[model samples]
Target chain A: MFDKAYSGKRLDRDDALALFNSDDLFGMGKAASFIAENLHGKKVYYTRNRHINPTNVCVNRCKFCAFSRSAGEDGAYAMTIGEILARLAATSSPFSELHIVGGLHPDWPFSYYLDMISEIKKAYPRIQIKAFTAVEIDHFTKLSGLGLRGTLSELKSRGLDMLPGGGAEIFDSNVRGRLCPEKIPAARWLEVHEAAHTLGIKTNATMLYGHIETYEDRVDHLMALRALQERTGGFQAFIPLSYQPISGAIDVTRYPSGIDDLKTMAVSRLVLDNFPHIKAYWIMLGEKICQTALYFGATDIDGTVVEEKIAHSAGASSAEMLTTGEMINLITKAQKEPVERNATYEEVSI
Target chain B: MRLALHPERVVTFIVDRNINYTNVCVNKCSFCAFYKDEGDEEAYIIDEGVLMEKIRETISLGGTQILMQGGLHPALDLSYYTSMLQKIKKEFTINVHGFSPPEIAYMAAKAGLTVRDTLAALKDAGLDSIPGGGAEILSDRVRSAISPRKINTAAWLQVMREAHLLGMRTTATMMFGTIETPEDIAAHLEAVWRLQAETGGFTAFIPWTFQPGGSPLGRTAGHATAADYLRVLALCRLYLDNVDNIQASWVTQGIKTAQVALRFGANDFGSTMIEENVVKAAGVAFMVTKNDIINAIRSSGFKPAQRDTFYNVLNYF
Candidate 1:
């Protein structure tokens, strides 16, 4: 019983559910932990990359996000290539990888993003580019009036290395309709990533936490990713993003939350044990908790983020920059050796 | 873990901010509003300089601990955290309350060390205590659906258990009203209770509702009402007999709910975060003043005292 997946245990689904439904905290924790130890041997993973969010200007203002901004907001910005490069250039050392994910700008064609990646590659040939999430790809393809294959090929040729697993929030349209009503639906998010990986572009996946998502929604989210991972083997790692209550942008504050929402964070590590690397993103969770997250069942710490704005656009108040030394410090303090990896978890520069 | 022992004292307080450090995550919960995908043109990773500065600010404004957290990005490693803790301890005398169960879990796996070893290293680096992040609903059913990549409830407990067994202190938290039933919440409490019972390490138990925004889930119409929050609070106080302190979430239910929580079971006020992100990203707008928190607790019939991350009373007001 202990060796099998909880789903496969001898306990009747009813009994398991009842056990789950039971108020016995210790029993339940023991049961869950028993499963955890059996699956993961107690290790976590982290990364060493920087997120360069060049703009906040977007066409799809998903209600679930407090980060996106209309062109008119005082904070709304579309940083020029020079501005972004200048900021990224200040990174403490040459970043091993460059992470790029952003909104679906209604006007910016796919060429704009492709140009950015191409220019980045041209400037820093050693850096691996993990740019564009599934949503951005879908949005780009739609704007470019091209097929998924064609779009991916064109982007890859222009130095687009891989994709970041974003936009596959919940595969359930019911939930998607309520949260991000206008963005690409679950299938679209999947198709784009599938296309990218089919083209040999590896990607990373993520989930947003502390929101109105249902348990089934989370299960479906993972299953969808797992299925895709099984199919293309393109997903490199999985990360969990905590929801912030950004008031003015999307009105997410009307809800309630605290640290307990972290159940979502832990469960992800437990359930997705099959996934090779799980990251504790420092930017959203803060350095302290991110450091601590390693013990539970995580492995990656995202790299030296040079430029980022989404969480801040919503309400993240932590600094947007950390020296590579600082990155190493977080890992060392957590008592782990920081092994820097590129977009694909392949050692780039550690 | 040793037999569980509820702290000799029971102190509860009003809850407030869930101040996350970064939204640039690798673990993207379907329900999160805080994380921005790489090219969303708004994605960001928090700055360490600002974090140090915020620690100073939180300490100055009579703040106790900073609830620092972020997404699972792959670049940062153990060294990054050690220095942060070192700096916090070096700069200010504040309790360096940092890291959650999952974050600890991450380090152990990446460093290829045992949980105990990882925690020991963190403690030696000036880590004062652990905060309960990544314990969403405690039930696997809920976790798998929403955050499959996060450490599961059992693993989360294992880390806490290991931490406690090693004499590292911790806190417990719950975010309800999303996909879980009362039983799930109760089970969540039981997980903490059992761990606290075994290790006697949990300093406090905080239960709050889910805030849905920027997530794939629909917009939350109305959160668990104030009365609902109190009911849960009361239940936590009553059922989590092993955990000594209960906290009210002002960040969720507001000061009024926090005030009500004191009567239900809360004995302490949560952090006055000089900064918060995740909940704010979800679109919530709430904050607390040190004076206001003390007044709220005092009015609620408990003597107000400020405690650091470890529940060590810093001062009595």
Candidate 2:
């Protein structure tokens, strides 16, 4: 079974299930790492990027969301275009990508998102503006009565370079129904990514695992993304977001064990073979686990995220941003060469 | 190995009995509760008859080797060990994986022999391979503090290097999680890694946390958590890239944690000890059988293969 994955053969559902259920964790890790090394060598990809969440006011509050706030709440304040520009101006450090995603603010019209991205692009023309998630796009379609195509094309015209993979809680409707009933269904999430792909807009995909999701749910989620990648070949990377249960309706006391985290990382790498990269988003997984993740088939450590708000709001202990030197040290310690990448994964000099 | 080559979905374990010949010793490590003073009622050495009986029992149970490590006994001369090995080899057709670095160094010093000559003599006396022991942490500062009378870091490495040059493959071990920082752990791994790179004689590397149960260092610093164990285990696997096998200590860590260690870079599940005394003295007695290991490896989605003392696969389950 591992020989198949080792020989660059795509794993089927049974193989994935066997891997997920099997305790032969090191074998799975080796296979995943073989694929990773074969594809990227020892190079560990990271982006020089900043996360800009312009607002927190969301209409549909998901149970797993710790960042979203009701309108008029104490922390609920949308950044005006000028304020957003000022925030962007505060960083003197050169960055190559602007990762923008936020709550589905019902009051903000679709033009607001368009103008916000346009203004950022106008200011930083060279920086790739990977803005908005599929759910946010779905919100825009509802708000402006523009279908998915109309909303995505409009955003793309206004300097939206790529879609930041988010709001993909879990693909299993049984799990999603309990955690995020108001959020877009799994079908809508896939359709939105597919629509963006058909328009030739490159996007990343994510699966929020490790909370209220079964192993079968996780397998289903990864398989769906794999199927989508087979169809479009547009997913630049697959980010397995470990669910942070801060301020969520589905309350749990424990985070997933380090074993579970590494298993998920390894399995994702093995399962999502067609995807070019698998990101260990260091914001959710702290620097320690992220460093260890390099061996468990993680090719990308997300980025030097200068001020990420989402994971922090959910009790993540990592700093909002890691210095470039810090990230380099981690990659070097893991015996991986640190590579600075743009939003679309073009290797760039640090 | 799968990482070095293509991925193979097989995990191996050895069926061997760890025969502790004598618990009575001269150098009592602060972390060990297994040793006894010469006058203690519990300080009886294994008579030749009992030793042979244990060997027969091990062979009857389908064990391929006998791992004999013990406290450095002051009264027994080097002949006691050489004759014991000779007698075992003469009587039983079993591989004798005996004598850790500390034991070798102690015996060498007592017998006025150099480390190299000592290893040559032992090899002639049917010592097939060396088990990695007495390496609590290879840093001199940690070694000086915990086991002051035990062999120092250099002496342990010297024993291993001389044995390797003599073409005797040995295992490397680290007993960590006591009064050592991350730097100490890294230093221990680096020492073993450097030696392995040079000689390439290490058959496996095993790292287990210090059990502070009934030791003189009892419960002063809490035992290492499963996370700590796994982190170090993963780091050992990543760092000691030259070592062929990374063994998980199911005795120190329970079977479940050891099972999880398979994914974290443990290829060998270590020995299926018919009897173990050191860790049990530290208050952990996780007895595992042949079937227990086989099922654990198989249920974990790996082919459970049985190996000899030198990691040669005898058969696959």
Candidate 3:
């Protein structure tokens, strides 16, 4: 299996499944690390970004979502364009990207979403706006009475530079049924992404693991992403979100252990051979495990997210923010060179 | 290099229990989490009966040795250590691999005897060998920063040299990832390699990371990743050519990284510690049974063998 990976051969479904079941974690890690080094050397990429979940008032109450709330609920919110601009202007530090993913607000017209992107882009023309998931894109298509390609083209023209990888929770239908039945099916999610890619918008991909999903489900999800990337070549990176065990909604009782987290990261790096990067999202994995993941085939540790609410709503215990200095310190201590990057992963020159 | 030295593809481990006799100490090192003040409620010297019970339990579980170490108590003398060894030797047939260099230096000073004389007395009372502890970085610059009240580097080496002259085989250890530079690590490995060259009394070279969970250094010092641990482990194997054994530390790095350490040039699986408290007190504990060690070794493509204190194979699993 390692020989195949070393020779630059494409790993099939069986090869990925074997990697998932094998106990040779270090062997697999070494192979992944070697490939990462060959591609990027010791340079680890990070970004100075802010996550803005404009509102938590979502119509579809996905069973695994802890961030969404009903319209009349106590904690539900709907952020006007003015409020989002004010929040962005209040930040003192400079950032290269604004990661905007929010709940699907039923009452807001599709123009409200389009105006939100244009307003932020007009104000901060230098910062890229990576907004909306395929689920939200599907919601927009319904709200605007347009086709998938037309909705995505509207978002693209409104300065939506890229798509954030959310709502790709698990591509398996069985697990998706139990996880978020009201949300779009796997076919619709794939169709939305494919349309967005065809329109020339690069996007990130994600998989929510350690929940009710089986190893086969995870491999199937990766293979689907691989197949898509092979055709469109639209994925900028692959992010594996470790499922944080919440109290009431999700039935999972515990978080994934460090071994499982590292293995998932390593396997993703090997199987997603077409992906340019594998991100260890520190918001869910914590600082130590994320730092260790650098050697397990991870080339990027997401970003210095100023404020993250989605994972925190699900009971994540990591710190709310890490300064750029802190991010460089973490990467440096792991003996890797830290590279500050923009939304598309180009090195951000000061 | 590992294949050249250990051509049999056999990895070795010893089944032992770490019995810390006393926790009361005067030299309150900043990086240590197991030491306590003399009058603290948790501070205690092990009762003789409880100590005997621990040894009996270890023997019943197929353990061949007891790794006895403790804090530098101000009131204990040479008589205390000699009588403890005599009592244990008189009772059981287990090898008593006890006392690190710092403890020996302190006892010699308190007893008004040379280190050689002190070691001779302890050996006569059935101190079979010595286990290396308290040698954090083998550089006075690092020792002064982390443990100013403890022994200096020269004193630590002097104690080891005297023990070696007395025909006692001891192991050498380094606790890094705590305010240490690459030069300090190189100096540490060079120190061990030079000593092994001179006396050839060192049995193994064990290197582990500093756990900064419950210690004072936790505020300023960060933890080392498994990559850092493996990098240092591989460096130890390449640099210390005189030392025949390089043991991987499962207690600090966990079992997965330790299994990977075998490929990083480690030939020994360290000890199957039936009971461990020092690292546990620092808020990181990884407990494994004898079978777990054997299985980990076998799965890593090596034969797991049980060895005595002197690295003699007793059984191959």
Cα RMSD (angstroms) for every candidate in the order listed: 19.5, 12.5, 6.4
lDDT of 3 by residue, A1-350 (tens): 89988999988999999999897878888999988888899999999999899999998898877888999999988888999999889987889989999988888999999999999999999999999999999999999988899999998898999998889999999899898988898888888888888999989999999888889999999999999999999999999998875435877644455667888999999999999999999998877668878989999998878889989988787788888888888899788999999999899964
Model 1 spans with C-alpha error above 4 angstroms: A1-45, A248-262, B1-11, B14-317
Clashes (N, CA, C under 3 Å) per candidate:
188, 4, 0
DockQ of each: 0.03, 0.04, 0.13
Instruction: For candidate 2, give the docking quality class from DockQ.
Output: incorrect
Error of 1 at A319 (Å): 2.7
Better of 1 and 3 by TM-score: 3
Candidate No. with top TM-score: 3
Which one wins by DockQ: 2 or 3? 3
Order of quality (lDDT)? 3, 2, 1
lDDT tens per residue, model 2, A1-350: 69888777888888888887776666877888998999999999887888888898998888877788999999897989999899889987888988888888868888888899889889989999998888889889987787999989999898988997888889898888888899899999999999999999999989888776778888999999999989999899888886664545576543454466778889999989999998888888767667667778999998777888778888776778988877877788677899999988998874
Candidate 3 lDDT, tens digit per residue, B242-301?
899999998887665677688778999999887544332321222337867887787566
lDDT of 1 by residue, B55-93 (tens): 655554556566667766566677777777787677877
Q: Rate the local accuracy (lDDT) of all candidates.
A: 0.67, 0.83, 0.88
Candidate 2 per-residue lDDT over residues B49-83, each given as its tens digit: 87897787777677789999998888987889999
